[model samples]
Target: MFCYQCEQTAGGHGCTKMGVCGKQPETSDLQDLLIYLSKAISMYAWRAAELGFRKEEIDRYVVEALFTTVTNVNFDSERIVNFIKKGYNILAEARALYEKAASDQGRQPHKIEVIDSWNPPQTYEEMLAESQGIGIAARLSQLGDDVTGLQELITYGLKGMAAYADHAAILGISDPEVYKFIHEALNFLTADEGRDADALTAMALKVGEVNLRVMEMLDEANTGTYGHPEPTVVRVTPKKGKAILVSGHDLKDLAILLEQTKDKGINIYTHGEMLPCLAYPELKKYPHLAGNYGGAWQDQKKEFDEFPGAILMTTNCIQKPAETYKARIFTTGLVAWPGVTHIADKDFTPVIEAALAEEGFTEDAPEKTITIGFGRNAVMSVAPTVIDAVKAGKIRHFFLVGGCDGAKSGRNYYTEFAQKVPDDCVILTLACGKYRFNKLEFGDIGGIPRLLDIGQCNDAYSAIKIAGALAEAFDCGVNDLPLSIILSWYEQKAVCILLTLLHLGIKNMKLGPTLPAFVSPAVLNVLVENFNIAPIKTADEDLAEILG
Candidate 1:
């Protein structure tokens, strides 16, 4: 089982023995098989679309199927096997639809086929090739060295896109075109005939384009429902008493939990990507919504253990559970684990019970607050003043510094970069990367805080909206604005967001803690030459470069 779909793939290549993310070999193979089945469904769905099937039920399955394959989303082999069964069921339904269409048209309906064309190994040589990195690379090489590489990259990007799309759909926001693009892209990856370098490259860019749309739809869904984020200081200090630490990027889930536990004796502390929830008026209005409790996702094993209250993971970036805190943890939505109590659709009772059993802090702890909420709407509310400050030379630079946070030590660059940015420059950040410097007090440029914490990783949507608006206000292209995107990526969600930036022709962005191990040098060159993408240097160096 060879997999290289994430930033931390073993040795910057494929993970052959087991996943660095704690995925077993069997789990990895099932994920690959799951993706293979999803592609078959995609092909059927695409054909049905071509034949004028409008009310496509296959679209929902397509989204869920792709989402299920994302890193850290599903590590349970049992659940994955179940999803494979579900995918087969979906494929059967799609085949029936295709057949019915053909029958109505007096022609032979195209039969849905699952192609597991991988060569079966009989000899030691063949078995070795199938098991080693060289063999896996060869199969990927068949996708055409360049074409396969690009398709793999885009497939990872779509994984991220599907995650964001799934989140938006939960909020009753659905984009049919985004669904169409996903189906088309998934089919393209699996198609035997049209898989070529040029075609795959085009598909890759198109994934980025659709990801941009999904992010936009999510931005609209979030800000429209929760109100735009604004600058508000959120305390990092834990309050005295029992608390529930909510992690990951599900605002609706967080909102529901916040509502349920508001008057109870329990306190709600935001963790990891949930840090930005402090900006939402509805969420922040809850007096029991205490300050942030931990750092980024990668630090959870240590931080979660130290915390006294329960923890809820609404999404990904969860490492393997530590024994000390495993039972106190609860998972919701797409997140699942064998031992942890999972909060299902109708009931959060388990989470409440866990919180009650944990027995939070006995007395009131020290009170502290850290400001958050600077989403697009909140930022745009002061656009006129921001423009004035820029004109007045009070705000010298605008840094769109955000992305996923990871365990890599190089990530300290982000913390230092944000710290070293001129006090005159306002730093706009989203995702877990904001955890690095959100606590820093950079003061304000005019009325705007020097550091603005946007929403979750999906809230990159908010950053994009703010950038587009700033471009319009400044009467220039987004690239020509005073903004610089210094991003740090950990998982596939970052992949999709970066692709969206590329699709939009945003240039000179700095991507680091590390470049994705999946990106071949040739593909990296294509990005650098075309999009001016660069890796991050030291804070002093990058600061000079961006400000220069």
Candidate 2:
């Protein structure tokens, strides 16, 4: 198993024997095969699009298939094999679509040796063997490290884009532009041509450009389906009774579960990225919706085990379930584990039964609360006050300090950075990384809370909108504004978000708890020279550098 598409890749290099995320060699290799299948589908799908022929199901299948390979999303090899089998059927349909288009054009179809002319294997062992030819090391040998690294960067960015696009599709939102770019990008990776570093880098930024649109579509989906998030105080403590904890980034899954368990005496609590769901008017209307239960995904081992009710992981950020709570934890959507119960049909009756069986919180815990839901609408509503504060020099700077959190050692830098932020500045945070400092009091500038929680990672669109609005008000480009982006990335989603920022020509951002192992030194230099992007140093050192 050679994988290094995440920030926590082993020893700052590829993971060979097993993923640091606890993914086995077979599972990892099968995921590679699944990716190969998705790329094969895209090769035909891209041409079909060019020929003015497209199918929504084919587009959605490729998106979900790519999403399934994202870090920590799927660990069940059997489930992955099922996806691979399904992919072959879709690939045939894609091929036939291309043929129809080609026939219309009165020309023979174009072919690629490995992708278009290849036959998918029938069995699991054959699939594993198939992954070997297309694996990372094999590609690195075929193409040099720099080119392959850039290609992987684009691939990982596409995975992130697929995740957000899938989320938007669930909310009944779809865009052909997003689908077109995804297919084109994947096809570019599938073909042997255009593997030069400069070409690959340009494609990576284009992935960023499309990712921005996907994020915007997702923002619209969330705010339109559920009313725009309002500034509301959420309980961070547990309520006494039967409970079900919903972790991960899927708000739709949380809403469905809340409806199913509302009158059944199960109190639903959000964990990890789901913490922002409490602010949505449509979701927050549930009477039995309890409160947040835990921190980021990396701490789930201790937190999930201690929780006394059923736990449902709606999307990614799943860990190896501890034996103490293994039977009670369930996986749904694209998330899976080898032996964990999976809710494929969205009927969470099994989850409710398990919750009722367990002794949920013996009694009410001490009450604690935090304010969330400072999304674009919530923040822009008070734009006048924020603008006045900035003009009057009441707010010194704005710091965007959050991303996907992890179990890495240097992550405390975020907590310390937030703690050390000046009293006059505002911190706009999102995703699970907010757990590092959301619990602490950052006070407020006039009526504005100093720490603004801008929904989940996908809600990055909200943050971008907020910044653009602020920049417009100030009559300056975003880079000229007195704002600093301090981001921490753990997985592929973070990779795409960073790319989006760079695509916008946003500069001088600090990214850490470590750079991705997949980024070569030459590529790093290019980013640094062009965008002024740099890895984070100590909290104090970075603070001094930014403030001074």
Candidate 3:
């Protein structure tokens, strides 16, 4: 079980025995095998699509299967095995489609012996053993680190893209071209193209290209469903009532749960990435959709234990459930933990029951508040003001200091960096990383709040759109703006976003808490040369350079 896909991998390298996120080696191996099968399925799926046959269910399953393997998403080996078993069934249908398509075209299908004639072991134990042959470590020796690293880079980016794609699909928005690229990408991994450094690098950027579209699809799905987010202050203090805390990135699930729990004496509080949901017009109308509960995913163990009501993890970034609150914490939509309640089909009856059975806050905590909802639309609405302020030298610079937050040590760099920003600059942030100094005051520059939370990692499209607008306003490229991007990444969604930035030729961004272990030194050199990407220095040191 060699997993180095996240920033928290052991000793800044691979996790061999257990995951820093508490994933067991068995689960890790199973996830590896599941990805292998997905690639096999895609081998046929991609060919079938080329031959004019497509299956939406097969395409969607591949996306969800990849998302399930993302860091901290699914830890249940049984759940992963179920996906593997299901993949076998999907593979059969995909191959059948390819055969039918080829027959109608008056040609025989090309035989890819690697995936076509393969059969995986059936039992869980055998499946785990089979994973031994399919894991990334097995390929590292054969292909060498540089090529293998680039392949893994593409896979990681696809995992992030798959996550965002699934979210958009849940809201009834999707693009066949996105699915096509996904299958084409997974299929790319099964062939010789993955070993070419130049070809793999290009494929990685294409992953970014399509991911940009996926994020746009998600942005549209979210805003089209719920009206654009408005600048609104949220109650950070716990109210004196039964409550259900919803975490993870799925706004649709939260909305359904909000509708289910309305007037049932349960206040729905958003946690972590879900915090931005409070600003959406459609969701904010539910009076009981209370304020945010916690800061980010890493603090969930303590936060979940202390919360007196039910907790729901709607998507990724799930940790190993603690015994104290495992019973009350539920997971849905590709997130799973062993022995924890699993909510399927958007049902919240069990969650509501758990929330009511526990005592909520006995008394209202002191009224504390933080303003959220500074999405692209909200920020751009004040474009004239912001533009005028920047032009007048009232707003000196722009800093995008945001990405996935984790429990690593160097993450404090983001906090110190944000805190050290001068009074004249505006800091744009998104994802849970904003938790570092979000609650702290940055005050305002010319009536524009110095700290702007752009929404979840899913709202990166909003950030990109915001930058494009600023560039257009300034009559220059985004790179020419007085903006510095400092990102802290922990997971695959961040990977895809970084790829998007690289794809757009955005340069000189700082990325940490550490560079990915999967990126070989050669690949890192390429990034350094091409994009000027740098591992972060000390907060004071980095701040001095950026401002200078």
Candidate 4:
């Protein structure tokens, strides 16, 4: 398959035989074809936009198709093949719109190149044949790693923006600028005329800027739809009842599931990234909305096997299902597996029935609980006290240590780093990566919890807001504050968030367990020389260096 878009590429280079994420060769090839076609749609959409023709639907599809290709999102070959066919249809429509717009302006439409031209295949076999010539390996043959890496960096960042923008769009929040950038970035990647490293790198930074807008849109959509998050304790034990465990990042799916399952005698529990959903006032209002069931997506194979209930995945971050519990698992909204039932149109009837038929927890698992929901609103609400605490010497330093969680051995650094922080310092975290140390009791600094759980990875917006607030209060730049950022990234979403931090000119950030395989040495050097981005060292050594 030759995929290296994620952190855990095989042997730190590429996954050639099969995806480490359990994506089969056929599925991987189909995903590549889908991306290739989506770029064609983007090329047409960009030209159409110049002719005063624009379609938000096409713009959204561009983002979504790219997002579907992200790691651990979709694995069903049939589903991915269907997405490619659908991309062909979208591209055709976009091309017609572009041609019409050009005719209206009395100018001839630009000629379509072979790479950007596609026709729908009649069968999956034909689709696979078409994919061989359109994969990343072919693109790399024409461009070196440095140029290709920068292009992929921009493309992956756009994918992350699309994922966040899709979530916000569900809640009826969006920006035209974000959509315009999507079309522009896609066309840039699809162009046959090669771009130099400096130009590609410049476009990548622009992706970061647009990603900032995308994240802001999502922040507003989430807070507006579900109310600003507040600190609350969530039960870790599975309640005794027929239960439904919901995972992934789609709050809309969770809301609908809660509504459908309410008063039906089924208890709803959050799993993985869905754990933060419990803090939303709108979602938490359900009396039967029980508690969280798992730590992070990486641990789900074991966790899902152990949970005696139906599990629903509403977004990405799905693993290859285990045979024992595969039947009880359901997918929706771009997440797919071969054997699992999929809930489309927000209809979770299959999941509900599976939960009722299965044997749920006969007894509560334990009385353990964890605290979350220190979002921007919650933290800012206590801003005065925080400022006073910092001024009074009760809070000496701040560390934002969080990102995606993976199964790599070096991941223990995050847990160790969190554990080593002094009592006087506050460790703020968000995303699944926080699971590393979230269960460890860090106690509170006076009245403030030492380990502040911001929302999900998308809630990096909250961390940014909190850091900006702190900087404004202290009358210093964010880099000048007594705060350090320690991030561990797994996928493209983390790429966008890291880019957003860079867009804000935040420097000296530490990223680990390893740098992205797509980041060539030249690209890495650019990041280091400009932003001072550093790979992590041992936890003890990093702790000593940051404190020093």
Please give the ranking of all candidate structures by TM-score, highest first, separated by commas: 3, 2, 4, 1
In candidate 4, which residue pairs clash? Answer: none
lDDT of 4 by residue, 77-148 (tens): 888877777777787789888999999999998987663444566688987887888787777787878888
Q: List candidate 2 stretches off by more than 4 Å.
A: none
What's the distance in Å from true for residue 399, model 2? 0.4
Question: Residue 484 of candidate 4: its Cα lDDT?
Answer: 96
3 against 4, candidate with superior TM-score: 3
lDDT of 3 by residue, 1-548 (tens): 99999999999879999999999999999999899989988999899888778999899989999999999899988888888898899999998989999999999898989875677789989988898988989989789899989999999999999999999999999998898889999999878877899999999999999999999999999999999999999999899999999999898899999899878998889998999999999999999987988789999999989999999999987888888998899999899999998988788899999999999888899999999899999998999999999989999999999999999898988889999888899999999999998999889987899999898899999999999999999999999999999999999999999999999999999999899999999999999999999999998888899888
Q: In model 3, what lDDT does residue 454 have?
A: 90
lDDT of 1 by residue, 400-505 (tens): 8898887756888998998888889988888888888877778886667888877778888778888999999999999999889999888888888888888899
Better of 3 and 4 by lDDT: 3
Off by more than 4 A, model 3: none
